[model samples]
Target: MGSGEHDRILDAALAEADTAGLRGKAVTPFLLGRIVELSGGRSLEVNLDLARNNVRVAAEVAIAWAARR
Candidate 1:
């Protein structure tokens, strides 16, 4: 997906995480995995590094989404 749309999805995933009251390290990967699952399947196999990046991206996107709200 394009960066813009990807960011939008990440934002939505973050919102979902917030609504679900998820915390700690697994939240992002869980959200990311769910996003992938909903879109299709697990295209990218999750790993430590990828999970870490997902967490970062989720946080960034979530913050941006919140700012717009």
Candidate 2:
């Protein structure tokens, strides 16, 4: 994704987190995981590191086709 697209994706994900009433690491992980999941299938991952806080969060997502609900 380009910088602008990446930014929007992040923004939407953050907004999703806000809607879910979550913040910080929790939100970051869920957002990244969904983005990765949307991008592909079997194996997808996103890593976020907070340099100032020296914390890293990584998520791996896998998707399978769903039969009718």
Candidate 3:
């Protein structure tokens, strides 16, 4: 929720985007792990379905940009 946490999530998401190739379900677990680390071991509540969808879209966009380079 802080800037540092947000940056960490973005970094992880991008990494997962490049490596996982838009598979949201596959990527969600990794994202959740990163979130936990960023949150200092505290459990966080998130809408899994929405998170997966967002990650899928983000990964697709990232892939598209990568393809251009």
Candidate 4:
């Protein structure tokens, strides 16, 4: 999804969570679930892609650092 759409979904989810009085540790899961619902599950797919990309980047960084040492 475009960044604008992603931001809109996140803002809407956060607003709903706030209205529902979600706080502390409860907020993360609530927001995630709301985002998924709001985005028609697209958010979850994006999240998984981001996670995998992060792992790949971390491994690349580690390899580069090791080579320099």
The best candidate in terms of TM-score: 4
Compared with the true structure, all predictions reach lDDT values of 0.74, 0.56, 0.71, 0.94
How far residue 11's Cα lies from its native spot in candidate 1, in Å, is 0.4
Question: lDDT by residue for model 1 over 30-55, one digit each (tens)?
Answer: 88776786545433544456898999
Off by over 4 Å in 4: none
Q: What does the lDDT read for residue 22 in candidate 4?
A: 86
Question: For residues 1-69, what per-residue lDDT tens digits would candidate 2 score against the true structure?
Answer: 456756766677677778899976787679867666644432232332244233322221112223322
lDDT winner between 1 and 3, please give it. 1
Provide the TM-score for each candidate, comma-separated: 0.51, 0.48, 0.36, 0.78
- Where in model 2 is the C-alpha error above 4 Å? 38-69
Error of 3 at 28 (Å): 1.6
Model 3: per-residue lDDT, tens digit, 11-30? 87668666867575767677
- Per lDDT, the best of the predicted structures is 4
The TM-score-based order of candidates, best leading, equals 4, 1, 2, 3
Error of 2 at 61 (Å): 32
Q: Tell me which residue pairs clash in candidate 3.
A: none
Candidate 1 residue spans exceeding 4 A from truth: 41-69
lDDT of 4: 0.94
Worst lDDT 10-window in candidate 3: 40-49
- In model 1, pairs of residues that clash are none
lDDT at residue 3 of model 1 (Cα atoms): 67
Can you list the residue pairs that collide in candidate 2? none
